[model samples]
Target: MKTAADKLSPTRVKLTVEVPFDELKPAVEAATKKIADQVQIPGFRKGHVPTRLVEQRFGRPAIMQEAVNDALPDLYQKAATEAEIKPVGRPEVEITEVPGLDGKDEGDLIFTVEQDVRPEIDLPDFSALEVEVEEPTVDDDAVQVRLDQLRERFGTLVGVDRPAEDGDFVSLDMTATIEDEEIESVEGVSYRIGEGNMLEGLDEALLGLSAGETTTFTSKLAGGEREGEEASVKVTAQSVKVRELPEADDEFAEMASEFDTLDELKADLKEKAEADAKGNRVALARNALLEKLLDDLEIPVPDGLVQEEIDNHLRNEGKEPGDSHGEEIREDTVKAIRAQFLLDEINATREVSVEQSDLMGYLQQLSAQYGIEPNQFLQMLAQSGQLEQIFAEVQRSKALDVVLADVTVKNESGDVLDLELGGSEDDADADDASDDAADEAETKPAAKKADESGAAEQETAEDVKAAAKTPAKKTTTRKAPAKKAPAKKTTATKAPAKKADAADEKDAKESGEKDA
Candidate 1:
């Protein structure tokens, strides 16, 4: 047993397990005695039958079967201990050598265990880690959009005598038929003209009918068992109504409640819109910051996980990930895998984790997005086989939040970005990162060129790698980097302007989005 472990690696090992024949002897004796008692012999009483006679009748196979069964469990335990393997699931045991009573009296048990080992990780300087997050800010434009939506909600529809038009509210009686056979009909249904919220073609059919007027039309139902099922609608419009937008004056405002004038409403709407926008940007930044922190990670993502991610992407893209999405899928999967790995590493290091309550909280937020109750939404997720996925997502999010607490966040301009929970800073970073890398590449051609290498380029590539790993600056705090000034300072010397600055001035002559 001592020598067995010496041959195996510390991380994983296999052992040649043996159960001595001496250990099997007692079990064999007990079995033979039991058999002798059960069987009747002509010369001896059934209980008094000799062991040798029982052995002769049953032979070695029966004795060995009993011995093997008795010894297997203890043998397996001894072997696993000897190998020092933390068996995750189960072992596939094979009897390598079976003990025989004669020359081949003793047999050895051998088996192999394949399992995932807890990886030994190399920790970096956690305190030195820095990340950037865009802060949430309420903007005027965002508020305006919200206000417009609100205004639309407050507007009322009143009847008009002209041919029914868009945004009109019409009260009508309707009937459906195909080939002069009446299939379905209804009366006095209040349908919004040009708002196709219900059955197909009904709104458009109602647009032309006025009070006391009727129009007949036929069209197919969009999606139904009766798809391609044609229906004729006879609409008698009891009323035709258009939006009666309230007057922008103070008296109408007083009628609407809470506001003195339309301007005040618009301002409030603008503020809300801006707040929403800022909140959106902040949320995006938080997510982006988390993703970037994960970007620095190096780990082998399991093929099963990547394949799963690819399949999901393909399903969402509404096409097979094979061939077309293969490359894209691989790239995305690797990034996703890295992100998850980094978050896991952080979780392990800091002991931060998502609990069941965190998962419930996450579900509540998701439910809010769809305007559904949390429990109903949870049931939907459970029924759809998505509970685990949702749980994982929640964990990832919680992990990111913890990461934000631990990391230093700054912007490209070197200004410290504010952190917001559940923000969308990632999209901004994605855009800005590309721009930064592109700009960096434009200035650092030698570095980029050195990265493209074959045998001849190996030495230079190594040099580039060496340089990249070394920290050039200690930029732990948020501060916008200014154009580097020349060392020889004059009494009133201007700074050496950046090449990008020149391009910017050139762009200013053209439109904001025009080519530099």
Candidate 2:
């Protein structure tokens, strides 16, 4: 076999391949067998027809076409590997010539493939790059914020006769309409005033509404078939309530936490605030370093691939191919594709690899964010065929971490910050163990308390349900919303394979092929 690659553009390539007759023999035999199994012959049982008789009946050209189609994918993959080109999107394949078409198995199989590929990028020296991040510091205000958050967790919701205000929780019944025709409606939904997560102008409309009071507003629908379309929305507040927090004292500390006194609780909060500040600083530094690298490099994006992604995005949103959202999708898709290419090149250069522990840690973090059991989440990922994509993402992240380790980072005061971007394997293992131990310790006290108080289990279940409604933290890469049906007051189990599958599909829109 012989293969040659022609550079069509910075982000495109055309490969010409010639396969010897011997190389095509196996595919030919397999194709012959497949055809024989499908056809009925007078004196032969199904799938036991002679190759010569089948070839005579179907003609050599038909056999060659079948063999070519059967063997194309593997043949193209091998040729691309031999040519040393990292193809990105699907290739346009054309079979130019085939052997034995003229009743003589003399000529080699010839074909050409045109595809988009990763552009050659000259990465700048990482050691030469420098970025500044905020200094890791925990002030009294930060500690107070953490303490207040914890207090809120143990707070009780008391019914209020006054109008709803910011931070008040309200039970609401909502109805939406277009052109005086009701489009959607929901009743007895709990909403927090000023959260603004449900719809545009909802917070402002809900403010100042007392129990049994109704208000109307106009806003665009957030999702569904009429997403992005303006509609009239009416909301009725069923009841208004405000959270009454416990006093910051020894009694409150003992009831809310393991700490014996308020001072000890505050101290623990302060310590945690400090650790979070440091983690935030490290994340900021990493983002700054990545931004610097992206700015320094000139990576070409394939226009065809970008358009394909735009079409897919519109399709998924239930919009037409020429939807206005295509413009925005194109920009984001280009950036994501460029980032993927850049990280993939660095991954190859640094010989980065994903370990089993790395995958486990990532999966645990994701599962926690989505409020799903780790084992169940792993099963979902495997069922969706997204393990490989997840592995690639982890590899890219590690490659960036490798680059960050070599770069210099400083605080605003010009003091060099010792930001631990990525730690050694042993350190990672230790950190994981420490986290597990801390989680166990935290839960043990709660479990014991629950055993003492019968109603505590019901309260804990309610808390878990509330937490499940909270959105997951945003990551560098955008992910599709989990495909879980809403339950009355519990975290719904997600569909077996939609979240990761949608994400993988979105990222790899063009990572498939079609024969031309």
Candidate 3:
């Protein structure tokens, strides 16, 4: 077989291949034998039919077609190997020249294969890239806040007749109609005001409503409403309930948790929050390290990868992906492919490998989540023929994790710490300050007017603290500070006077000695 390759573009390649007639003999013979076995010939068995008779009946053109069909796989493989093309999809093969049976007995069978190949990648250094991320800081206040949430989780909801406050639960009845015909009406739906589980407006809509008041609103149905249609929802407040929080004392701590004292419980919460914060910091740092590893990466995405992904998506949905989504998915597919390449390079550099034990453990965890035994899940997977795919996914995840593990992790403090992403030391304080400031500014306009007043107050506080250690000022004049004034004058007088006395004493002794 003779072959030549042409580089069409970064993502596409063309291979022109030629196979001589003599090299195609085995394939031709096999096809003829296969046809002979299929056709019925008088006085001969199905398997024992003669090749000459079969060829004479079926004709040589049919035989040549069969031969080409049989030889395509081997020929394509050889051509790809020779051209060094990592073909991404099934090639569009065009036969340029076909063998003529009698007139030109032996000639080259030329074919042109056009297909997309894997894009070449030029990766950048990991150490050169840097990204600024908010560091994790989980302080004592955050721990206490989280502890409060945990305590509330154990507390029972009590119904009361009062205006809906921040920590109140409201019970309501709602009717959803598609076309003014009520589809479903839910009653006694107990929901927290800001949980956001229900439709977007429902929570905010329920916030101010009293126990006996009714409110009507429209919400878009989950499934597309009748092509450009919206649902009319009527919500009625059945009852307004408030959370009766237990006291935040030692007694409350003993009742709510295993801890004996409030301080101990608070300490425990702080520890938990700190641990979570550390873990988050490590995760962030790991990502940063990966970004650093992939500083100037440039890679051609494997052609057809995105389309293949879209096709796979459609396949899962039991439909073939149309050409409409081809261009749009390319952008996303390129991003995904780049990420994969970075991860792959990192894995290779670090020699990251996944263990079978880890995969089994992950599967067991998944099994537990789904409330099935590990073996039962495995059996189901085997029946579905997705067991290998699951393993491949596991391998890929473990490989990524290995890279993440080897990367650097540190908190915003630059203290070589591993902390959780959102959990931070000053988070509660920042939240509290922001909330109080905003609330005060809104409810009492005087505070917003008093921002300058607040800055002035802060300035006065600084002046008072500064003046505390310094000596008192002189009342005589508005001159420089008088505390250093006397010291300067005294040192000046004593030095000159001592020098004059020493000179006078030396002169007197010399005169008396000369007179003697």
The true-versus-predicted C-alpha distance at residue 71 of model 3, in Å, is: 4.0
**Weakest 10 consecutive residues, lDDT, candidate 2?**
485-494
lDDT of candidate 3 over 197-285, digit per residue (tens): 45547766777788878888886543222312366878887777655455678887787679899999888888878766654554455
Local distance difference test scores for all models: 0.47, 0.64, 0.52
Candidate 1, residue 118: the lDDT equals 23
Candidate with more favorable, higher lDDT: 1 or 2: 2
- Measured with C-alpha atoms, the lDDT of residue 117 in candidate 3 is 67
lDDT ranking, best first: 2, 3, 1
Instruction: Summarize candidate 1's per-residue lDDT along 165-283 as a digit string, tens digits.
Output: 77666666666677787766556555555545456566667666668888887766433234336677676887776655544566654555488887786676666556555545545
TM-score on alpha carbons, each prediction: 0.46, 0.74, 0.57
The residue ranges of model 1 lying beyond 4 angstroms of the native Cα positions read 1-109, 113-123, 133-137, 155-282, 308-328, 353-361, 368-373, 382-389, 418-516
lDDT score, residue 472, model 3?
26
* Number of the top lDDT candidate: 2
Instruction: Estimate the lDDT of model 2.
Output: 0.64
